[model samples]
Target: MRLNNSKKAKFFYFLSSLILMTLFLGAAFFVLEQYRFYILGWKSVLLIIIPALLALIFIFSGRQIFEYDSDGEALNFRNRNVLTFFNKPVRDEFPKYKLLQYEFVNILIFKRLYITISSKKNNLIILKYDVSYLTGKELKDLKFSLSKVIKANQEREKNS
Candidate 1:
């Protein structure tokens, strides 16, 4: 199964970026008109460059999709960094046979789920979002599916 960012999450992201863009444009206008600033020096260049980069980041993130994919045998996850053109995806994959276990957990009072892919490696964490509660249900469903995969694999091995 695949899980993508929810509509409400995307709406919040879009709205937040829209507000930030408006603020940056407003600041640029104020600096140019009220103070008669020009992008001629390092300081002026910084003012223009920094806000522009920040605006771009906000816009890019707003357009981004956080996706999670899992099958019986392997799990893959990555962010579709939408504005990053020509960027190759760095997909993280964990095979079922190596999976140890999983649990809903908290550390330092932060709530999240962790799936142990291997004892030698760090657990794959379900990323948290304050605006979304759907992840909890999804992760549990994924865990259920993965368990079935492991059991089936074991049965096939025994019958062989």
Candidate 2:
């Protein structure tokens, strides 16, 4: 199940990004116009370029990547950004023997269903759990779906 933050969260992101974009781009334009007035010479180019580029990147990085297996056997996700070029994608294969744990986390104005897996392994949470935003119904459905798959995996593990 692909979940996303509420509309309010998205709107907040948009408004903030829009303001930053306007401010940075406007300043960049003003600085570029004052090319000859620069005492710092090449340093002026870096100053104008950095914030303008950051603003553009800020807008782009808001995009999220989500991928779940058809059978709910695995999930992978990541943020769409320049860092993604270096960062490996987060992937979790619903492990058979590991016990799953979950809770409701309240961060600022948001409520989220947080889940983690426990096992003999040293990893605290075997899956790189990105906070996927889900509505009440979606959360319920995810819980149900996970329970089913986990049970099936456990049975298979037991048989083996």
Per-residue lDDT of candidate 2, residues 1-160 (tens digit): 5543434455545655675776677576657656646566656566566666665544433333333432444543332222344345454555434545556554543344455667566576633333334446755765676676567667876899
Q: What's the distance in Å from true for residue 153, model 1?
A: 9.5
What lDDT tens digits, residue by residue, belong to model 1 across residues 3-113? Answer: 666454566556556756766875686578546755454455555566666665454332244456765567665644333552444456766566555555544323344
Per-candidate local distance difference test: 0.54, 0.51
Root-mean-square deviation of every model: 8.0, 7.9
TM-score of 2: 0.43
What value does the lDDT take at residue 62 in candidate 2?
36
Deviation in Å, model 1, residue 20 alpha carbon:
5.2
User: What lDDT does model 1 reach?
Assistant: 0.54
Summed backbone clashes in each candidate are 0, 0
Q: Top model by lDDT, which number? A: 1
Query: What is the lDDT for 12 in model 2?
Result: 47
Off by over 4 Å in 2: 1-20, 26-63, 70-88, 109-113, 120-128, 132-137, 149-160
Clashing pairs in model 1, backbone N/Cα/C closer than 3 A: none
- Judged by lDDT against the true structure, how good is candidate 2? 0.51
